[model samples]
Target: MHNISKNNEKPEYGWFVKDLIVAFSIIGFIGIIFVSLGIFLTDLLQLFFIFAGIFIIVLFLWPGLGMAVMNIILDWKDDDITDSFDEMKRLEIPIILDIGCGTGRTAMKIVKALENGGHLYGIDIYNKMAISGNDLERVRKNAQLEGVAEKTTFQYGTATEIPFEDESFDIVNVSSVLHEIHDREDQKKAIKEIYRVLKPSGTVYIGEWNSRSAQLIGYMGIFCFVFKPSKYWEYLLKESNLTLMNVEEKGGFVLFTAQK
Candidate 1:
């Protein structure tokens, strides 16, 4: 799956770092055995698994390191959020929806982006994700920590079918989650749902990977093979009855804002 969150993490069989650690452990152990048996000396393929093991180990132990590396590769900027919020101020008590809110990070960021008080709804398929803190209780606790729980509502749901009424929100933010849905049709449905839920003149901000070096893209591809992160426009095609507002590229990610 693509795992689009506002910017980043995954469930059982999903993004649990422990899974990577286990895979690395097994690969490393087997790699050592193969190397000692002279298999790697003749067959270089064994070396690939060994290095991959090391990379996974690094990723498991220090998640921040991975984000740091991505920043270097993508040229991350912090101002896109500021701009998004500035635009949101035009509405009164805007109802903001955050789709794919892994561990509530993107949801919290959206809460902070609001200059004035606004009701925020966060949705996620967190049942199987493996981020450091991803349980429903943890999300609730995080919202408490952020002091936005009263105004925020976290729900277990998928982007394909948002659980809300039509024209219920003034702003909808799908950060980094669209790419996680491997099926192109599902991605389009998610966008359609967002469009359906948005009121006329409402705004949407989709933050997802757009441009990146071949090496980096290949690297991420190994971890998330089903991801179709770049073909984002498929979800916001011109014929979708939505108006494209602004498109900005920030490093490896692109933020596309639109109006409905």
Candidate 2:
């Protein structure tokens, strides 16, 4: 492995830190007001204010805490990728495409999994707010650090308009990326693009969060609104003319395996 000094390693803040900070700040402001009111009100009113404040804090804090536990402590993303890869049929010298491969996290993992002389192409919009250090240079550097530089290629690209020729790749992996495309029409366009670039009978793995799942409700609370139900993705795949082969749901996260 390519070794780097400890100080050179930058932390990745995936997608939700800003939202979490804003939410907690707003809740803290409201909590202060509630506490002030309790200081001046009658005993019964003060008790009600205290309980209300606690309830509000707990409710809002739950999502952030849950996310931290899942992403940090449990390493949910890594586990999810591993599980998905285990289910995939092995390919010899496969040409793989990884969409929205921020900082080479998923791309590096996939490249490393290839024992044959396979190559993985990773593309992303590199939105700064989506992932800390989410830039082409950062991903390139990560691929080098992970010792997969020769096996991987990183570039600036979008899902709707993938910068590649038709039938160029043998397999495609898209993890937690579709929801970032806010417009439903654009999401459909992206799926079509994936279909256009895939070789005949090529496989595609799409991972997404199910907004309606109870686990998602507990983890994301109101933030679950950011995701779509599993049915939405199934519809998109079918409409794009991809054959949906399997749907795996684990802890509110769904992985759809389809074929071109």
Candidate 3:
């Protein structure tokens, strides 16, 4: 574990994993080339289908490629990748946990969203294979930059083994973090841990790639598809100790909410 601090360079709160984005982008580019070749080689009707396939492939692999247009048409009513805490605001929750909080991107946002005072705890493993900008020092600096350092605390922890006591938080969030665990049983174990740490009636929220769209038909979907994510999470949430509240999918990602 390490302490967070401000630095000379600007702090980056990136949402996309840089390595995955690059790998998928290169594959998407190659796919486009092949599809373009087939466009000219096939009938006009076939050409239309080829173009459609290419478009979806690009959107799936390239993060935020044409997201501006998507933003204009789709109403993502929730704040940037957050809805659980937004709900908590209505209840004036005092203690919150952002499990797998990478670089305080969502953690800082959670702090700002609080009109009522709430202390936010963020935990993550800040090692070499951690997400793009996942560093304890960086998260600390980011919290400082966002002016929420006092409202938030950064710590070292893993999803399968959270460092908090039972029923420790009123609200808990685990976003785009579980699928990173390759083992299916371990993923379920992590969800169980989420349930273990929530107070009775406390809310637990999770967001992840569901691979339900055209992304599933392309190379970019390979990573998330391997996990059978939607099915496992659905089964676990319904069968676990929590009451499933709401579930929705958008922009190739899914959000799930439950109450303990």
Q: How many clashing residue pairs appear in each of the predictions shown?
A: 19, 0, 0
Q: What is the lDDT of residue 219 in candidate 3?
A: 29
> Mind giving the per-residue lDDT tens digits that candidate 3 earns over 1-260?
12244555555665344555556566667657767776777688567657765775665544423332333333333346654445688766569999888877667767787887989999987644445666888898877767788899998999899999999989998887887787878878988898899988889888776665654333243443543556668887887878988887766667788888
Model 1 stretches with alpha carbons more than 4 Å out: 1-18, 21-83, 218-225, 229-236
Structure candidate 2, residue pairs in collision: none
Please provide the root mean square deviation of candidate 1 (C-alpha atoms, Å): 7.5
Best-performing candidate as measured by TM-score: 2
lDDT of model 2, residue 67: 59
TM-scores, in order shown? 0.71, 0.84, 0.72
- Per-residue error for 157 in candidate 1, Å, reads 2.1
How does model 1 score by TM-score?
A: 0.71
Candidate 2 per-residue C-alpha lDDT over 1-260 given as tens digits, one digit per residue, 9 for 90 to 100: 33454667643425434455456557756765786788788879999887777666556655656654555643444553645764333778889999999877667767877777789999999877666557888888777766678888888899999999999998999988999999999999999999999999899999999999998887666778889999999988888799999899987889999998
- Tens digits of per-residue lDDT for model 1, 1-260: 11323433321112334444445445545544544555445446656655655554444323333433543443333233545555677876889888877777567767766776888888888744345456677777667766677989888878898889999999988877776786768867887898999998888888876534354454343443334445446355555777877777654556788889
Cα error, candidate 2, residue 155 (Å):
0.8
Q: Candidate 3 has which clashing residue pairs, if any?
A: none
